[model samples]
Target chain A: MMRKTRFLAVFLMAVLTACAGAGHLSNWHDESMDFGAVKTVAVMPFANLTQLQQAGGRVRDTFMSMLMATGGVYVLPPGEVARGIARAGIADPTAPSSEEVVKLCGIVKADAVITGVVKEYGEVRAGATFGNIIALDMSMLEGQSGRVVWTASAEEGGVSMKDRLLGPSGKPINDITVQALNEIINKLFK
Target chain B: MRSSTSFLNRISVFLITSLLFLPGCASVKAGPAAAGPVVGANFRVAVYPVANLSGARAPLKETRRMLTEMLRAKGMAVLSDEELETFLARHRIRYLGGLSAEESEWMKGEMAVDAVLITSFEHYDEVFPPKIALTARLVSTGIKPVILWGGSSALAGDDSEGILALGLIEDPGRLLEKAVGGLSDSLTGYLSGKEERLKGASWRAVVRRGTEETGQGPPFYFTAEAEGGRVHIGPFGPKSYYEAPFLAPGKRYSIVVAPFLNASADRDAGDIVRLQFVAQLAAIKNISVVEPGVLREKMLTSRIIMLDSVSLADADLIFEGLNADLILTGKVEDYYDYQGPNGTPHVRFSVSLIERKGGRMVWTSDSSNTGDDRVVIFDFGKIRTAQGLASRMIRVIVEELFSGPLIQERPKGVS
Candidate 1:
């Protein structure tokens, strides 16, 4: 009887943990912001912290695709965003000042500007397990007030037990990146 | 039973891992959306030179040319570079920034334009994975030139690597072309109606209902007002000096040029006018023009020294002699190279188009550089000689006549 109870308890714990581990999403947003007023948004370059050289740009592209897919926003083109950055004379595109953000928004005629950082990306290996991973942090700043209106951070991807035991066939980097992006974007909408 | 329980545990672990790695389940609330501008067809607009802000040296002129073509394809009457430049110079407007109320009224009264379009390039590069970004705005030329419609778009080659790798886009130029093509489509779509896709790619746009003011709404809706209604009473009563009626559509007409009469003191004014008319008429695709050489030979052979205004009988005789549908005759009323006050050169001339069937006047128009017209600052005195003024005068007249609704339709499948 003791053994059976222990097994049942372990099974229930596994199920609950599986459900809880679907995503880890944390967000911070200013309550005073009128999101409805944000009709246009410029997506700025994302800072890359990973070893991969193109990780930042890859993640940024994914975020742009997902954000535009939401249909609630008119995402300015990346070239336009670069122009706005140049016109603002931002010394550091990844980390711009509040004043720079406002100036860029005004130049691009965007209601808000979205920026992000790619924390982790690419394939990883741990002993007998292997998988692709992606982690990102994103923020939205209002153009007029130059205040951060919304923010979200998320991390996704890990080796599944099935893959680990069955020979560790990892998912593609692009797939993992997209899944991680979707996870974080879901938080923004929520 | 023990072995079966172990297998079940393994299965459970597999299923749990799969579930954990799957996409997350989150719901999004409805957010705010933007509306596109509603504009009428055939609105006359002037596109200012694109302001290049891209740190790189991008081909701004090519981009402007592409934009102009796209606007024309959408049935908008875009002003030529010469015309716009002239207007700007005459008014002493150096910058293309937001126009003041007084400047806007002046443009409206003088140019008879409905809207002004301004475009700025934010980023443009032709390097590996070329990139381009631009923003455009259409402002009304009303009492206040408020922004009526605007859009911004950017695209990079890196964003389309998948398509490139798949051999969809063969070269960098093709990729840039695709990007600009998408931008143009999105812009035109926004102007005409709401597009379901936000960007030009596969992403679908969320539809928002109702007009929620964000302090960016247009001042007023635009209506299609009657165009080219201004009439000037020249020596003739209430004749069109700046506007001409559009020619009948779907008709092809052959034109025979008769030498214009040199009413001015300058000896070469008539020849200059004649040469300019021939050159301009040759550019019209639908109108078949008899070669100047052929017409000159025929005139010399017939001993026709027809000068000044040709009488109806003489016009009819020439029309029959040349087997022409229309006879275009003109008089160089005033051709003077003014060199003194304010340093502005002026040219004035009048032209009349006569139908061959009854020798009746079909169209008569005249223009003078010395009028109160606010936008005639082309080749001001120092740069303009008599020849230059004559060329400009003829060009202005020809453009006014041919660019109107008077155009022959191409046969099916030719375009």
Candidate 2:
């Protein structure tokens, strides 16, 4: 009976941990700036703080594709953005200053600039089960004033109930990344 | 004891019957049937090397051999593979998308071939329920080469799966044979003048997910809709334009399909999309697609690179170089193929047509599609390859652009 109680306790703890890591999202929008005015935007290279080498690039690409797919705005081609960055003489493409952002927008002929950061990406373990997790933050800056109009942060994926009960059958890393990006996109439009 | 023995006998009969009908579970859907030879039995044809755009290393030699066999089976003379290779090497000709007017005339003089067959292997999946897709076009070689016929075929292992999942194909080779065989039959039918156009595009347009209602918070340029729960921009939106209102019917127009800008993560996606457009546009009866190789060569020699859209200055250069009436260019947003049993292919791109004379934008279109767009129940109509899906999508776009008002016999008295 004592051993049975211990097993149940461990099982309960695992479930609780998974529930805690489910998903999170936070966003802030400035009503003063009209998002409709922003017809074209440039997505700069995302900053990667995680251990994964290409996590930043991967997440940024997904965000751009998903955002463009939304049909809400026209996302400039990466090659054109690169050329704009070079012409603008921006030393840091990943994290651009407000002045540099304005310069880039001018050269690319975009109304806005979008920057992103990949904080956490890859597998995370909760109890005995392992699953994919992706956490990211994104911001939109106006072209003329170079002021941030919208900001959002999102985290998705983790060990689920099914995963804890039955071995690891969680979603793939790509799916996790997409889910996280989708959450942030929803917040942007919201 | 007698009753028990009777039960055993009944069970045995049931088991034996099932074993007999097991093989019947697998089914085959024959493509367009082959008609009699209409290209005269003495016509000599050369099959070029199979273009691999599937993003996976395919069995090129084997596929060519099968195509050649199918062509010969229809009572047409096909140049040997070795001889074709030797000719290609001797001429140092690598571009296989389409032959130029000069090259076509030269081929008529040297090789004496009446037509050339260009084939592209778009998708070849080796996993369970193996899927294969390919496109073939026959262009005549003379003073000016014209696309005689074009056909595409795609097959998935579970396409014909009946109840109980009995008809699952595990062998990729069998799937390839069926796909190739169907294409051959379709080509033969077209050659015999029995099948004019293989099959019109019947797939529905990419739909927007209901969950993503255009956000009311901000005034946006166009309503955004997610096709298959994935974001897909304009073309279906309110401002999307179908055909070039300025296009004249029954008039042959020279077109140049420029390389698209790749916005997706996939490598060479722009090139792949460009070739697809070239192949389809060439098959249009009223349009003459310029040789892609010649255009690429000119672009290289002139050192012209398009940053985003084609500018007027660059347009003039293209006009002066090739006398092209319209320049077709766009950006490929996404071109991806999922793996495994439940994976689906996705493709998205937008195109624009620019007239060279005044350098004005005449037409623009956006397309997004998934393999499972129209698939319903038991995956009966699922497209398993990105190439198959893209071809279907492009076919619809092209047909809709040229159909109805654009190409209708300019009203009896209005011309």
Candidate 3:
């Protein structure tokens, strides 16, 4: 009886651990727009909605790195993006107007522009478990039409069973951020 | 079973206690605030001596030099220290503690400065993990000495061991450079009409706490807002300093290269400048520079007197005869190819450009070196030779002249 009870408890713990913060991801896109047509894209600075100072830059960098790693699209260098922003005299990089986006695309010779907002980032603790959470929403605007062709939002991160039971740490914030970015990029290409 | 239940209960209690004591990891971030548009396009700024309020001995002069270079790179005309000293001495001003209203007026009349940048250090340590806290204020020298912009920043040096593990140098100089670079970046970001969001706690509050602990007051006033561990400063308007480019980029223009007149005592300086000017111009794709031999032949055939100082009339006559779009003529204001006490090579010169038809002065650049310039190591390497320095200076001049909107060939179907 004790053996069976131990097995049942272990199984339940495993199930709870697997489901911890599985991440809710949703995406929207303009179906008429061809995702394959985007040959090059410029990732603008992301707006920060969280209290973390560098959350926007950190998430944007991770997303850019992951998107570039996929080799699906040519990503414009961040320095070039900065120069384009300066030349375009963008009042707000995070929320640039369609005109500014088109101007930036023209300056950097990108087919599309990617921008996003970092809604949540950093550590959160519940009960005895600690987790590093990141929530992000990204969108790609087509240069020719100055309209958003694709958008994706994802919130991910939760303490693993090992962290809760054994006091072992979960994945680093950067790793979690990368995972969240991969999910968004997967949906973006899909 | 009783023992096991007790063990589970203990574990549960421990988890609850840990949760109750969980530390808050919240941080604050400040973004750029909007400000009015910048008033002027060009500004001549004077950076006063940085007062050291940090009890620790800091390299104030080195920091000042670095800030000067940064400002110059941003296209600001920074008055050299020697010029400042000369002006102060001529005015019988023995000590420049701070800029009073009267002194500001005097500076305006004497130095023709548009702004005065005052800086002070509250904390600067050079230990294994260096720390630097600095405050800067840009005061306009207009009729009223209004504070155009202000900022304060604090930087804690990165762990040397960690940096070394990442395959980077962790020397004290590098740490200090990083700290100073951050401070300069903040200052320039404010001055150039961009907003810099500072992370971490309020540097002013931190300094105030330190002062409270040390039983002293902060050296400078705290005008910046600090809340939720973040300090928000200025948008400070757009960058006003402008250097007119000789010609806009992407357009091909024919230019006549005139021999540079030697104004310096160095006899070969003129030749060096002229040779470098022609060589660099030849390398630029958008500029079609007339060959030196061709230019001389044209001058001789056109009966144009090639004098040291070409007047507007002379420039017009030459332009009409040669049918060139622009004339590039300058004087070698100064040139020195010598090694410093530390075996560092140095080169300095000044050059200017003019439009041919209207004889309008378009661009001018002067190189200044005080032998105190810090050597910056990059992935590519450092400038080591006089020729390299000359080439670098010429590149800066060329970039300044041809700096504007980059012209791109639009696709057939795209606007």
Q: Which one is best on lDDT? A: 2
Candidate 2 displacement at residue A129 in angstroms:
3.5
- Interface RMSD of every candidate? 28.3, 7.3, 21.5
TM-scores, all candidates, are 0.32, 0.63, 0.34
Q: Model 2: which residue pairs collide?
A: A69-B231, A69-B232
DockQ score of the complex predicted as candidate 2: 0.13
Q: Write the per-residue lDDT of candidate 1 for residues A1-190, one digit (tens) a residue.
A: 9999999999987975673313466888788888888888888889999998657755665455455545456665454466677668999988777899899988878899888998888776757567777778999988997889899888777655555557656566655665676667666666
Q: Candidate 1, after superposition: displacement of residue B145 in Å?
A: 38
**How much TM-score does chain B earn in each model?**
0.38, 0.75, 0.38
User: Which residue pairs does candidate 3 place in steric collision?
Assistant: B41-B240
User: Candidate 3: lDDT over CA atoms?
Assistant: 0.58
Residue A13's C-alpha lDDT in candidate 3? 83
Best of the candidates, DockQ? 2
Query: Residue B30 of candidate 1: its Cα lDDT?
Result: 11
**Rank order by lDDT, top first?**
2, 3, 1
Best by TM-score: 2
